[model samples]
Target: MKEWSVLLLSLTAAAFVLFAGAGTASAADGGKILIAYFSRADENYQVGYVEKGNTQVLAEAVAEATGGELFRIETERPYPKEYRETTEVAKREQNEGARPKLKSTPPDIGFYDVIFLGYPNWWGDMPMAVYTFLESYGSGAFAGKRIIPFCTAAGSGLSGTVGTIGKLCPGATVNNAFTMLGAEAQEFSDGTRAKVREWLVGTGLVK
Candidate 1:
C-alpha cells in the first residue's frame, strides 16, 4: 500500500511539472502566438445577422486551432454607440490621421515568434488601434520572425494593410494573411476551422 501511494505521488509531480513546462514554452515560440485583435464589443451588423463583436469569435477559433494565446485589442475611448455614428467617427479619425489609444498592453513580444493580427475593416483600411499597437513595438525587436494576419472585413479585403504592417516592421517576415466576414464568423463552422488548421500547418507554424 505504501509503495502504491509513493507511485501515485511521483506521477502527480511529473504531470504538474510537464504541464507547467509546456505553458512556459508556449509563451516563447510564437507558438504562443498572441491573437491580438481589435474587436468592438458593440452593435455590429452583418450580412443577415447582428453581432456584438466578430473579431472575438474569429480570434478564439484561431487560438484554439493553433494552440496559441488570445488577446483583445480594446480602446481606452470606446467607439460610438450607433453604427452610422461609429462609421462617421472612424472616417473622420482616419482622415485626420488619428491614433486611438489602446486599453490593453500587448503580450510580451519576447514570448511570441509569430503574431496573428486581426481586426474589423474600418473605412478602407485597418482600424487606428492597430497602428497604435505597431507604433509601440516597431523597433525591429521581432526581426526574422514571422507574422500571420487574419481579419474580419466588410467590403474591403486586406486593402494593403499587410503592406502597411511590413513597412512599419521592416524586420519581420509577414505572410499567411487571410480574411473572413462577420456573418460567416457567426457560424464558427468546422470548415472555417479546417482552413485555419491548413494555414497554420502550411505556414509551418504548427503540427
Candidate 2:
C-alpha cells in the first residue's frame, strides 16, 4: 500500500511539471501583447458607411484571439466623413510627411513586449496619424520589442508599410504583416475570425 501511494504521488508531480512547462512555453512565445490600431469609419471604400471601421474589426479579432489590450489611435482633428475627401486628406498628409496630433495620451508602451500594430493602408502606406502614435512614445519606447503588423485595404494589401515600420523603429523586430480586404473585415464573418485565429497560431501567439 505504501509503495503504491508513493508511485501515485510521483506520477502526479511529474504530470504537474509537464503541464506547467507547456503553459510557460506558450506564455513565453506570446509574452504581453498589445493590439494597437488606427481605424476610421464613415464612407470607407468598398464598405460604404460603417459604424465601425474595418481595421477596428480586425484588431478586435486579434485582441480576442491573443487576449491583448486594444488601443485605438485617434487624431485630434477627425477626418472627413466622405471617402473621397478623406483619401485626399490622407494623400496630402503623406505627400508632406505630416504627423497629425493624437486625440488622447497613449498608454505606457514599455509594459508590453509585443505590439500588434494595425491600420488601414492609405495611399500605399500607414496613415500619418499612426506615425504620430508610434513616435509619441519616444525614440526608445519600441526598442527590443516585437512588432506584428496587420492591415485592411481595398486592394493594396500591406504595400511597403512593413519595411517602413522596420525603418522607423530601428531596434524593433518587425514580423511579416497580415492583410485582408476592407470589405471582408468590415463584415466580421466567421471566416474572418477563423483566418485571424490561423494567423495567430502561425505567429505562435495562439495554440
Best by lDDT: 2
Count of backbone clashes for each model? Answer: 2, 0
- Each candidate: RMSD: 6.3, 8.2
Local accuracy of candidate 2 as per-residue lDDT tens digits, 1-207:
999999999999876543223332124677788889999999999788999999998888777667788999999999999999999999999999999999988889888888999999999999999999888877777889999999999998999999999888879999957999999998878787677766777776666
TM-score of each: 0.79, 0.85
Model 1 scores a C-alpha lDDT of 0.74
Q: Tell me how far the alpha carbon of residue 68 in candidate 1 is from the true structure, in angstroms, after superposition.
A: 1.4
Give the distance in Å from residue 41's predicted Cα in candidate 1 to where it truly belongs.
Answer: 3.1
Q: lDDT of model 2 at residue 51?
A: 94
List where candidate 1 sits over 4 angstroms from the true fold: 1-31, 47-52
